[model samples]
Target: MTCSTLWCALASLACLLAAHNAFAALSVDATPPYIKPCRKSDPELNQCIKHSFEHLRPYLIKGIPEIKLQSIEPLRIPKMVMDNGHGAVRVRAQFSNITVIGATNYTILDVKGNVTTYKIELALSIPRIETTGSYEVNGNVLLFPVRSRGDFWAFFSNITGSGKIYGKEVIKNGVRFMKTEKLLVDFKLTKSKFKIKDHLNGHNVIGEAMNQFLNQNSNEIIEEMKPGATAAIGKHFKNFLNGAFLQIPIPVWLKD
Candidate 1:
């Protein structure tokens, strides 16, 4: 990402996180935070953003290479493990040939300080996610390496989540310093569309049973995956914020 784009993304994220933190601490007692309308020429806000961005570039760059999101096409999964029913069974799968749409639209409600409150809309379609891992049921009573392809659609509304910034203060060379707190985000999924197309494997009976299990339990499976997805998006923003605000001096506004 270019420097300006990265900074803008981080600033936007900081605004989101600050709002979420207040909401969490106040237990809905706090008024929703709003993004301050300020021009690039605005003295305090502009200076703070510029200084903070410059200071954070060092630490921010370190983590950028590590932040990975393949939202475009053909998302590859070397291995994915799913376990349900109190560890009674497990499925290891590899996902590929994925196509997604409407998965990255974020509507910002408010931006105050380091916290931001927003609603995100996401819809995903995986044409085929190949499953080629062993399934073990009840301590290896049923064990086999299977293959399957799934076509799934997931959609949700008003997905609310939170991200909190945590850090400490210190003095270096007689100058006060503040660092970004760990990123904490919370999220949930309500209703969505999930489907499995066809199952293929060596064992006929077990394959058919597994396919039926997935078709019947798609809702449950989606629910199980929601939190991880939410955390991932939240963490993407956190990485932005960390690179923007952490390595350098903390902005004066976040101090309050």
Candidate 2:
């Protein structure tokens, strides 16, 4: 072959090889057997979805609720800025929260020196919420280091609560399945609202609403499910429920 023709042939072969490798990689990364996405016209899609959820059935069962209360000793309170210039006072208070079905747990840490701020910590037991399983948590309050003057009282008072269960799935399980790159839980809360009372006047003031947000990289849950580890997945689930309870708001009279 002529020199020019030989050079063109070699370049074409290299391009073909590269394209083949790319296609192979894409095929390898696609969903494996028994877990393929369904097309709209395919009747098998429903069955596939159903079977996928069935494998996660254990997460759906409602186990007995378990509650643990631990008093956190006074920790060094951090300074917080308030509307007034007076230095915030340090109020040492017991901190406790609950966990239910899964292996995870959450706790209220402490209020900031100003008492206007609160801190909370959450620990998950699984890598992600199960797709076949369902979870529902309803109420107003969500998160800690309650930020406003009335947030603390309102959080405690408007604690009306409920939760619903739908389904969830791990969209992307990262390398070697050690982590889920994206975890999604599909559910809704029936009544999620927050009520704050004036720190001094005790007057009621409601706040903005709550809505669903996708939870990603649920490392908390994954960490608990480490190989051969005898962790209580149910307790973790319950912890999720209790965390939901904290997010909800109860009526003032209920607090009394």
**Considering every candidate listed, which one attains the maximal TM-score?**
1
Q: What is the TM-score of each candidate against the true structure?
A: 0.38, 0.19
Worst 10 residues of 1 by lDDT: 1-10
Report the lDDT tens digits of candidate 1 across residue range 1-256: 0001111222333532232221122221222122122233344643443344344333322322212212212222232223232232333333333333322223333332322221222212222222122222222212544455543333344444334556556454444344455565544334333334444444456545655665566456545444443344454555555443333332333433
Give the per-residue lDDT of model 2 (tens digit) for 53-155: 3332222232212222121111111221111111221112211121112111111111111111111111111211101111112221223222223222100
Error of 2 at 155 (Å): 12
TM-score of model 1 vs. true structure? 0.38
Per lDDT, the best of the predicted structures is 1
Worst 10 residues of 2 by lDDT: 1-10
- Candidate 2 deviant stretches above 4 angstroms: 1-46, 58-97, 100-179, 184-187, 193-256
- TM-score (C-alpha, index-matched) for candidate 2: 0.19
